[model samples]
Target: MTTTALHHRIDGPDGAPVLVLGPSLGTDLHLFDAQVDALADRYRIVRFDLPGHGQSPSPAGPYTMRGLADDVVALLDRLGMDRVHYAGVSIGGAIGQQVALDHPERVLSLAAMASAARFADPESWPKRAATVREKGPDAMVASRPGTWYVPSFSDTDEARRLLSMLRATTAEGYAGCCEAISGFDVRDRLAEVRVPVLAVAGAEDPATPPQMVRIIADSAAVGRFEVIEDAAHLLNVEQSEQVNGLLAEHLADAVAGSRHG
Candidate 1:
């Protein structure tokens, strides 16, 4: 599959191990601001925006999971990163899974946060794509508060900033990702992922609940599962300190395991 030139930002010292962070759909790389701030001192953090989400240029519609995964690999190649630890939220997590499944050698570890091995029924995504194309990204804005965070967090300034990202997302870009998600189903292939996997779920997340996230942990060769209370789909943003602690430990363990092996 052809790769898209995804827009990205790099942080941390030159010689540190590379750690790639992927953002959920609608939100840009800034979705990982908290993680970047906490981990950049020890890891070379690379955060990227999906096609047309932030600074990335809008490409044609109907992208695939493999295609999005390829875009990440292309970015890694450009940055001269041979292998790295990866963590992502929602659609970003799906892409991380795809990368692990397709290019295991390039991933040292995987953290799937508020994500799933398979998103909702495949048919629903195309319909969502159609809605976005017809009404623009604004159409999905109303439902995000309920699905993305708890009622309390939804009304905060941080939540408003995230919602603005969805509003600003181009119809074609958002719809294209929706189509990509429609075709994404890696449940059966989870066992093929050899790297260690950390699957996190938000206790209040109605989108990808703990049950859904647990499937990833149960199926992967080396996996762990954890749930954070009082958060929803965008748990990393809502529970930054806890999420950062988990990631720090996961990355450290993976590095140590690699060294011993």
Candidate 2:
């Protein structure tokens, strides 16, 4: 319920290290709900709605990946956070990559989940963006489940929650993110990421897929990869425990290394 230019919320131990969690395009900061209780004990968790999603107001029209990444830096500056550990899913992960590339000093570590250096086919995004722009969010709902989750997860409470998140999202916001993702090709620059980058994949995710994530891991100078089974695009929610454990370890190690070295 707190308001900012970005609409953020912070919780967990007061003096703990900062951990900023970003959301995929369809959902807001709530995408990390399942991971919060598990990691909050050790981190000051900052979660926020991206522009035009949930509580955050959208900018006029289209948004670039770099633009969104800069918005995050602004949020950190607004809160007096010099640097922080960053984690995100899908579009969120893409933003993390941009930050690491463009604003290296601001990231302690990165957890890039269910994301890739580039979308499988870059051309597909503008088409999708155009559809949402013309028809609206409902135009995307019909085919989302196929890429978002395994067939079995489509009926669960979490699935319903995600569906609602998608519906509640503004078409312009979603389309803007699509434009961002469409042009996002950071593969050539991955070696420039100085911080540790942990790339995570859902084994069954048809969206970004495992191969895409592995490429991210291989591309980064200090990247590592993990694949969680029985999950799809929304791996953090479907396999929350496994993803949380991976993230907790990555963040801890990153923090320890940053301080010690």
Candidate 3:
């Protein structure tokens, strides 16, 4: 395993097929614990805490999505991973999209989970941005529990644990992610992405919602969408079995696509 100043932690069997994972905003790499266990034997899974979250120290105000994309590239360079299969949820997805568009050769297959192609709604985001900046990631938690987990899942220990992670995020880091969200505009760049893409949407996802996820999946020329039943925003956590199965299938296709094209 390797650690960096950016606080990125990468593990799983070395020299196995690489899959770089980006977690949801407000939460850290723990969100991917279940996924790592499922695929670690066969894949070198790389997961990291974005700047200012988890072990990563907070950065000064206002970082753009492009800036976070640069951070991913830097992490890959540090790890000597020339190219990798990319998977991201929420803010991580947005960063992956930019990376694929801006640095195509570094990406093998791209999977975006509960993420948008662009900030579809502009008027509603500023207040959210302000909240994170002033009150920190914890402030966003009260309103997020139901939106992030399925109805039944919300009451479980796993849900509370995940919520704790989200609530623990620093204001600077969370706001930085929100800054990336606000500035993210990759609609025109989707056509430029030559990589195979998979969009995973939770059927009950309220944050990005199913319709919004569909629009993102449809926007890509070579993309498909998979819906996980009885899941919310955090589909990977709420519906582990279904999400893992879809990941296995989509990642295989992504690898095949890379070989052919």
Candidate 4:
């Protein structure tokens, strides 16, 4: 299976510990702007765009979570990174799970925000993929505002920025990622993850509710779950301060654990 060399940008100190950030489907690397700003001083922040998103090449159809996780490992290999702290949202979060399960030694810790071990109603993802393949990413834009954030955030600049990213996403890229998500299910494999996991959920997230996020925390060998109030699917964007604080603590704890281990 050929892997895509995903487009990426790096921030923070040159030799600091690496922290990789993955964005949700339809969004690009910019989705982690807040996290980069908050953590760049201490960690080498690497943010990558999924296939067909941002400047990444839009390859053909049918991507798998394992394949996507392999692409990430390829990126790490190219960058000469032995291991990293990982965090992701939505499909990105799913990819994080796959990474930890598939390449346990490469991941120091994982923070999955607004994601699930197995997405609910797995069949619906392919249908969404078909819709995007037929009508393009624009077809999904109308419903995203509600599913992505609370009603009060709709008109804000941050909200608009995210929406713009969705509108700009290529149909092939968006649909292929959807196809990857459709077949994703790691509920039974969480027991294999040796690294620490932090599952953050938006209290009001309709897409992947708190219960879904909790499953990852409950199943993993070392896991913790948290819920942010008045947020939805994009909790990191909607509640950046709170999310950032949680991440800071999570990463710090991981570092301390590694030192003591």
TM-score of each: 0.98, 0.96, 0.94, 0.99
lDDT of each: 0.93, 0.89, 0.82, 0.93
TM-score, cand. 1 vs. native: 0.98
Off by over 4 Å in 3: 1-4
Those runs of model 4 whose alpha carbons end farther than 4 Å from true positions after fitting are none
Determine which window of 10 residues in candidate 3 has minimal summed lDDT. Answer: 1-10
Residue 247's lDDT within candidate 4 is 99
Alpha-carbon shift of residue 188 in model 4 (angstroms): 0.6
lDDT of 3 by residue, 202-259 (tens): 8988888878777667877788898888889999988888888888988888777777
**RMSD per model, one decimal:** 0.9, 2.5, 2.8, 0.7
Clashing pairs in 4: none
Quote the lDDT for 57 in model 2. 86
Model 4 poorest ten-residue lDDT run: 137-146
Q: Residue by residue across 173-256, what tens digits does model 4's lDDT show?
A: 998898898899999999999899999999989999999999999999999999999999999999999999999999999988
| Distance from true location, Cα of 12 in model 4, Å | 0.4
Please give the distance, in angstroms, between residue 162's alpha carbon in candidate 4 and its true position after superposition: 0.3
Supply every candidate's count of residue pairs whose N, Cα or C atoms clash at under 3 angstroms.
Answer: 0, 0, 0, 0
lDDT of 2 by residue, 2-69 (tens): 22288899989988899999999889888899889899888999998987789988765567888889
